[model samples]
Target: MHARTTTITADPNRIDAGIADVRDNVMPAVSGIDGYVGLSMLCDRSSGRCIVTTAWQNEQAMAATREAVLRMREHATEEFGAETPEVREWEIAAMHRLHPAGDDSCARVTWSRVDPATIDEVLDVFRTDLIPRMDEMPGFCSLSLMLDRQTGDNSLTAVYADRPSMDASRQRAMYIRDEFRRGLHMSAIDVAEFDLVLHHLRVPELV
Candidate 1:
């Protein structure tokens, strides 16, 4: 599977309107397009940062929607009262879900980098080592890892039942993250937590 993510820094007050537009407008339009799979949106209200992602059956499918989706993306940005957005394409590397996310769920997203040549090894470690640990975390809902193979840039999003559960798992999560980073020689670029405002992404389990 392939995915595209559009990151926008919106006017904090306009977030709700932006989200509503995505849910009621953008989603319906995108769903009718060929090869459409699923869509998800994450928001950090305090920072007015939102990430909207759409998954496609393949790279070609994703590419084909670029022009068509552009107008909608621009409209979303305008609805949010945000400036230009940042966009990226990724390969769905791995996905595992213990349960579907609920309205109260939240997600922690981490962006990191690894040598492109080590991509396969990194994925192996993620599947064999990281996933099992995450599965045991309190209130875990799901996790998805997306990779930009050529650039070796990757993003991992882990969802929890609620804010409290996500908070409770922080210490252990950090420990596991540290160990994984050290073992894989991965370099962290950024990390942020957000409310999982829209969780309809229906990408199949890929682990």
Candidate 2:
């Protein structure tokens, strides 16, 4: 799968207004996407930055939806203001589902590379060695990889159970940081904390 993420800075007090605008105005096209799996908008009121994540089946499909995405951004900025948002694209390498609420849990992930490299061996190490270790962490809920089509910066997101799970098991995820370099890849440029909500379409109506 693939995803597009945007980080935009806006006035803290007006965030709720911004979020409401997106829900009312920007979500219509989301329901129309071909490979669109899900979309999430995350915010940190103190940090003044909000993140928007859209997941798709492939890079090409994500590319095809660019016009729609750009339109959403323009609509968002009109309400949130005219600041340029930091943009990043991603490819979803893997995904694991979370149990529905009132049953077990609710957290999920989407990841991509932070370093830009097209070498075959680099990807091999990521898929073979690096990603598996993420799955082994305690309370690890799910995994997904994203690669930007333009810059090639990969972002890896691992979702977990709750505050306790993320706090306790994060280091285990960090252990593989050195391995990326051992594969002659660049070190992580930056990593961000993300809160995710995952949805799957091809499922049975167990209720």
Candidate 3:
């Protein structure tokens, strides 16, 4: 599967309107396009940062919708009273679900970079080492890893049942993340937590 993410920094007060536009407008339009799979939205209300991801059956399908999505993105940006958004395309490298996310679920997202040549090895480690550990965390719901093959840029998101569970796991989560970083020689770029406001992504389990 392939995915495209649009990151927007919006006016904190207008986030609700922005989200409504995506949930009501953008989603339905994208759903009717060929090869459409699913869409998810994550929001950090305090910072007014939102990330919207749309999944497609393949790279071609994702590419084909660029123009259509461009317009929708512009509208969303306006609705949020935001600055220009940053966009990226990626391959869905791995996905695992222990349970479905609920309305109160929260997610922690980590963006990192690895040597392009080492991506396969990194993925192997993620599947064999990281996943099992994450699965055992209290309230763990799901995890998805997305990658930019040529650039070796990747993002991993782990969802928890709710804010309290997510908060309680922070220390252990940091330890595990640090361990993974050292073991794989990966460079950490950024890490943020968000309320999983929209979680309709239906990409099949891809461990």
Q: For residues 61-138, could you state the per-residue lDDT of candidate 1 as single tens digits?
A: 999999999899999999999999999999999999998999999999999999899999989998999899999998
Model 1 regions more than 4 Å off: none
How well does candidate 1 match the true structure in TM-score terms? 0.99
How many residue pairs clash per model? 0, 15, 0
Off-target runs (Cα >4 Å) in candidate 2 are: 96-119, 149-151, 197-207
Worst 10 residues of 3 by lDDT: 177-186
Q: Give the number of the best model, judged by lDDT.
A: 3
Candidate 1: Cα lDDT at 120: 95
What TM-score does candidate 3 get on C-alpha atoms? 0.99
- lDDT of residue 122 for candidate 1: 86
Please provide TM-scores, in order, for all candidate models, with all chains considered together.
Answer: 0.99, 0.73, 0.99
lDDT of 3: 0.96
Per-residue lDDT tens digits for candidate 2, residues 64-98, read 98887887887787676538888877655444433
